[model samples]
Target: MQRNTYGQSPPLHHPVPQHVSTVPQLRSPPPPPGSAQSQQQGYAPTGQQGNPYQQQGGTSGNVFGAYGQFMNDPTAQVAAQFGQTAFKQGQEYVEQNIGRYVNVAALKHYFNVSNSYVINKLFLVLFPWRHKGWSRKQAVGANGQEGWYLSPRDDINSPDMYIPVMGLVTYVLLSTLIAGLKGAFNPELLGVTATTGLSVVIVEIIALKLGCYLLSISSQSQLFDLIAYSGYKFVGIIVTITVAEILNGGKGTGGWIGWAVFAYTFSANALFLLRSLKYVLLPETNGQPSGPMQTDSRAKRNQRTQFLFFYSYIVQLFFMWVLTRA
Candidate 1:
């Protein structure tokens, strides 16, 4: 009321003290070396901070780094794709054609052939003359067994691939052993021998297929049967070579005994193939020739059969000769 002239007596003149708030200062201890917080702050590990020569812990990092460049490389991708494609194609081909060529179940059945049957067949294969009641054309026995048959019995549907495969492997192994005994073993030569023998078999298969084609015979299964039949020559080959090797008696080559055994086996193999393959080479007709036309056709078929039968003999002889050299 004394200074009313200043404005309304200074509005009661209540001097309120100003309040000032202060926060306590904090200094967190510097993060310990190699701690999570320090690492999070982009600090290097304790020993590596100033040492450029510090070696890494594991070498796998370097390995991964080297190969990783190719992981995305276009050329590597192309090569990988190509290899996969080729492998798939080859697998498909084998899956489709292997059974058509080599039937393992049939092979196993034929491989179960008895020793007596083999011996009898061997004799019949060699001589082929009618001996007692056993002839090449005698039907399979009542016991469902092929008895004294040269080739595979017509009724018995087993075309064995096992015997021939075993025979080939045994022949190669024996030949290698013989070469080793003579101090002339060469692994290279062993490979050559295998290739030679395999080529001969392949050629025989091809030739038989060609013959069937030329004859206008549409029997792929029969052609494969013929191949299996032809492979039996390996059995004769093994026998002939073994006999020759034994009779040679360190002579380094066969003598008269070897040649004689070879001759017998060769003839046997030819005869076996002749009787075995006749049905395939010349399928018999149920009807007899009733006219000149029929006779002429029959005669032509007979001539072809004879020619093919002789061809089989010649091929057997050549292959046997090659095998004997081992």
Candidate 2:
């Protein structure tokens, strides 16, 4: 029985193979948590998740803007730039011309006449063809037909040019008429009675209106100021002519009348020439109401000068009425 017990214990043995027990299973371990490899492979991470805010690009709001502003031509912008520059330059020219030491308002008025003179003279000299065309065109009138403002001297389409020339001519003629009237009535003109000229005084009053019209047309030369000054000039010229005639009336028709008329015309012209300098220097700016500032589209013609030149035939009717009444 002792020998049988010892043999049974030695026969007991294990079932598993030696190689299979030594191998470690060779399988992948579970992903830790939120790994990039897990996401790329379409597998879930085990634990800690990723922070999306810390993405590769970081925060975004683009700092750059559009490059080219215009899609078409840029000519309009160029024109506007040049125009603004010219306007500013013109302003500077005016400031420099008047000086820092002159009565601003009075200076402005002087410039009104001066500007018109230069514009017309320049127009005539610079663009004679255009000026000729201006003269040929039928002008509109106050009577509703082709009107006359500057009759003979409308070579320029600008009113400032025509008005002053006509105004000066009218002043001279008015002086002549007054002198003629004085001779008509004054016995002293025949050398018998002693008297100052009276007919001329009345004519001077009427000439004032003509002056007013010119001033109004020229700007700052308003009819009122023009009228008064016109009357004064008439009286001065007429009185001088009349007195000369009275003193020389005894000389018969020895060309005294012609001499006096020549003197009156010349004197008026001299005054005009001097004043015209003001216009030439000051020339009208565009914003003003009158002078060259008036667009050529609106300025018709110089009716007065035309009347003196072409309508001299028509003046007889006016003279007849005035002579008979006065």
Candidate 3:
């Protein structure tokens, strides 16, 4: 059997035995006995010519009807809404009631005054060449999704890679757009916080589909697909900061920065959730979802996602230590 780019076995291959066969005849299964019809009708014993549904007693038509029924059910809607839904709603409810009392304008003023300090510190994390003199692109070889070796080359739109890219990019863009709109207009509105967070979750999931544009362009591994798109988000933060500085007369307004970061953090969670979902998503049978809703990976992904949510409010820590201190 041909090995995949990864050292591990590919998902597509049948499991092969460890030892090579020394005696082929001993391993072969005895042929099925001839049916009486073969003798009565003067038929030859060709195995391939038997009924198509020999062991499985049905046709493809039966499966199609079962799927049709699933689509028409209402309970599936409730299940779809409830994924990590409890915690997300609870957090939003708290943020809306809590954040309203704080003087948002004063907070914005503080952030504006602190912008230069923040910007100088943030330069290292944002601008690699200026700060660290180093750069990293998407992994070039077997570190990719196939579990192969350092396989050569990179393609952003590879079949395995495109879905994650779409899921990530759509997530970030939608969240940013929503937060920017909210901050630009109603920074302290309760609805903005709740709507934006829920939007992040919904878009994160909705983005998983294999779509028309991707069908035309995707040709990379799943890992590279995800990483490349995330690179663009890094670029986006740079752009947002540059614009923020210009609009706020050097130190950007706190309102805009807070909401933008809020969007960014939730989007990060979306990325983790989408990637973990990819891991366990076996091919659907009869149009059903592949695995249990609460797999181990699903739980891990949710933990990281939840961490991003709470951590977003204190993003100074992330930028200061992780990004600025580099």
Clashes of 2: 22
Across residues 51-132, which tens digit of lDDT does each residue of candidate 1 receive? 3322244233345566777877899999999999999999878866876866744444455655555555545545664433
TM values, all candidates: 0.54, 0.24, 0.21
Number of backbone collisions per candidate: 1, 22, 13
Worst 10 residues of 3 by lDDT: 149-158
TM-score of structure candidate 3: 0.21
**Residue 252 of model 2: what lDDT?**
24
RMSD of each: 17.5, 30.5, 31.6
> lDDT, candidate 2, residue 75?
71
After superposition, the stretches of candidate 3 with alpha carbons farther than 4 Å from their true spots are: 1-222, 252-326
lDDT of 1: 0.64
- Residue range 1-326, candidate 3, lDDT tens digits: 67877777766868899998797566554344476644343334566535433324323334556667776677766766785698799987876777687544323322232334334423332332333211112333464432321211222111132222343444445434544655653445345434543444334323422331222212223323333233223333434444555565645424566446535543543343233223223212221222223323555555544443433323322332221111
Q: In terms of TM-score, which candidate is stronger, 1 or 2?
A: 1
What's the distance in Å from true for residue 255, model 2? 3.1
- Measured with C-alpha atoms, the lDDT of residue 71 in candidate 1 is 73
- lDDT (tens digit, per residue) of candidate 2 on 1-326: 23465475354567967675556778686454467665544444433225333232333221221112332337756876899999999988887776675445543442254545555554443233333232222466687564323322332332242333343344445444554665654433332211122343345435534533553334443442333222223222333444555566634222656355534433443343223222322234533323553323323234333322221223222332232222
Candidate 1: misplaced stretches above 4 Å?
1-158, 287-296
* Candidate 2 residue spans exceeding 4 A from truth: 1-221, 232-236, 239-243, 246-293, 298-326
